[model samples]
Target: MRYSIEEMQDAYDEINRKERPLVAFGGALGGALPAAALYFLFAQIGGIFLPMLLMPAAVIGIFARYTGFPYRLKPRIPIGILAMVFHFAGCWLLQLNPFVYLLGPVCAGVAISVSKVKLSRVQEFAIGRAEIGKLGPNKSIQPTAKASAD
Candidate 1:
């Protein structure tokens, strides 16, 4: 049975509301772990530039995952700005090279732009599952195979 758009939307909204807290925690943890590892690894090896190159990428990738693809400027701009602020602050505290300060916004922009190009299949599957769960199973319906052309 087909469900109305409103029904589907409500289901999605409900799911999002319920998952928001968990998603936020997961995003933060996911972003932080790799970044911390990279920072420590680079610090031990005396490689400052490598962490500058990779840390932002890790954080931005996790941010993109939680925020969804097809990034809109209105929503993402503030986030990008916030990330830049944090990056600059961290750099200042750590006494890192000033040149690397620019990497944060650049990485944020690239990640946001690339994310807009395509939605991941996993996201599509999750959305489909949510909709189907809302609509309930139709046991009466049976799958059928189409005849192949010889």
Candidate 2:
């Protein structure tokens, strides 16, 4: 079936506003965690650029949310790869321990790699799932036509 302009817009919007708990988790691990962990572990020495990994993670997160999909290594290939180098360099360059800053890109990438996100109720509705209404108005199973319409 063809999609109306409004429906198409809705779909685009849904894609634009997809869930991204992974990015949040990644950010926590890549940005805040490494900074705290490295600083703590090395007693405030500049560790690898572990925190830099959070940049890609953040980018991936925001992009994933926009596109309604998980991070793609192929699409973000260069940056994704460079993230690793940055992490390593941040540690050595900054004189921070590589192990301590291990929470950088690697952790963020892994975190984003395996995150699951559920669509919003509005999205479910737009995708043809019927709203049962507030306070559970109707929960009964109906005829195929009605069910199919929804």
Candidate 3:
């Protein structure tokens, strides 16, 4: 029932190896679309508040799916950068306050980090269950009946 260190390492490596480029694409698209929408809608919509609130939500939701999926940072960095660039571009096109540029990336970063933590915990739980399965059922404990005196 015992697994060697090498076996555990192999399992960990296998779990980390399943990387997909689609995650980066999805994350980038998630951030860009909302920013584009914000830029186009700013003047016509007549209010900054709604777009501001909705855009980050859209980015976070989109990027959330790809987090904690065993991908390397190389792909993810670009996705975040692309999203930030789009957000900055949107801000530039709208000529909104300068501070808005920092807001989007910061919010996105926090959301992504939180999502990664949550998902990683789920992965850990799954791994624990699998390890438990390898140990088989518990047989050491059995129910015992006490004789009653008549």
Candidate 4:
């Protein structure tokens, strides 16, 4: 299956429109925590490394749920990267198996890419509104009409 450049560009634009820095950060942390938790859980299991299996799904789910799922490569890339970095940190600090460093991030990237999930229009609106809340009230702008009249 081949995709045209226009299709890719449109997807990028759509994703950019939905992006909120705070939401992205929240999503990143949301995904990261699970991987960290799972890593610890596996460590308790005598280094079974089974927690790695859940990393991809957790990354995909948390990110998509928290951030507006634009189904574009750009948005998912950051989530995957964040999740991977978190996973890597956990592994390195805990001294998990060497292979997990490679596997964890790769699996997250693949899962996010293949998920084909997207945000509904209402969900997108809600996320945007929530983002505004996180940004705090808009105190930067004053009433220009009054000043002009005065």
Candidate 5:
């Protein structure tokens, strides 16, 4: 069956809205750590501009790992681009020492991934809020009871 233009457009929009904001944040943060560390150390020996050199590699590596690797083998999806962006902000915007920058993301990822590490009740609530909703606005139009029973 053919879909009308409106149907297709609506479908396209729904998919776009559901995308999580965490991917870029995470990668940028991850990359920032290494970049900053290298930059700082190199700044001492090579100069200010030199140590910051590794930033590109960090960004690219994080992007490749989070965005590319998982998808290549199978399917690819991100929780939220927000996390990715946050991670980047922590590293670059915050100017965390490289070592310090690594701590937040590593710990944060582990806590979110393993489910063993404890988080505050409030913290858990915040994360839970981030979890995706199902059969909701971002999804395709589904038949209701009336539509289905007809």
Candidate 6:
């Protein structure tokens, strides 16, 4: 199962080209939808809690799905940042609690961080065109025992 560097690069480029747009659009939608939902939820409920911390992470998860579990961090960074920025912008628009607004960056940071970890785990086990496609641009790759041994 030896892959030449060129082959690896080809796979990376192929995956990136296919994934970048999907991840960007999906991440944007993910961020915007939740922000709007949370805004309305807060407007109706009028309370905030730690569970909100999950929003950005969820946004990142959506973004990661489109990322196709690339082997590098460079691709994941932008999607995470975009999710945060969109989340913050939506919060600002909805006039959410100042505390929630303040938490936007922090939440985004946590989401992005978690995405990195997931990406690493996925890349370790993702091999071959079939596996990569199955992993898809928007799915997370889980590390199998074979990956751990490597």
Residue 5, model 3: lDDT of 39
lDDT per residue (tens digit) for residues 24-140 in model 3: 456556655655665687757756873464454455435544543423444455455555566666667778778776666664454344223223443454356556663113322
TM-score of each: 0.46, 0.32, 0.51, 0.53, 0.28, 0.51
- By summed lDDT, the worst window of 10 consecutive residues in model 5 runs over 71-80
**In angstroms, how far off is 69's CA in candidate 2?**
9.4
By lDDT, the best candidate is: 4
Better of 2 and 4 by lDDT: 4
- Steric clash pairs (candidate 4): none
Enumerate residue pairs that collide in model 1. none
Candidate 6 to truth, TM = 0.51
lDDT of 4 by residue, 9-128 (tens): 344446557556446546666666665677677668765645555554566555655565435455566666665666667768778668767767566665466433566554445334
Error of 1 at 100 (Å): 2.2
Where does candidate 1 have its weakest 10-residue lDDT segment? 134-143
Give lDDT for model 1: 0.50
Candidate 1 Cα misplacement greater than 4 A, ranges: 1-30, 50-54, 66-70, 114-117, 120-150
- lDDT of candidate model 4 versus the reference: 0.56
What is candidate 2's local distance difference test score? 0.44
- TM-score order of candidates, top first: 4, 3, 6, 1, 2, 5
Task: Indicate the worst ten consecutive residues by lDDT in candidate 3.
Answer: 134-143
Strongest candidate by TM-score = 4
Across 70-92, the per-residue lDDT of candidate 5 in tens digits comes to: 21111222322323344455357
Sorting all predicted structures by lDDT, with the top scorer first, yields 4, 6, 3, 1, 2, 5
The positional error of residue 138 in candidate 2, measured at the CA in angstroms, is 34
lDDT, candidate 6, 1-150, per-residue tens: 565444444454454565554555465456556656765675577665656645655656555654444334565566566667766775676666667766666666665565542332223344444354654444334444555555
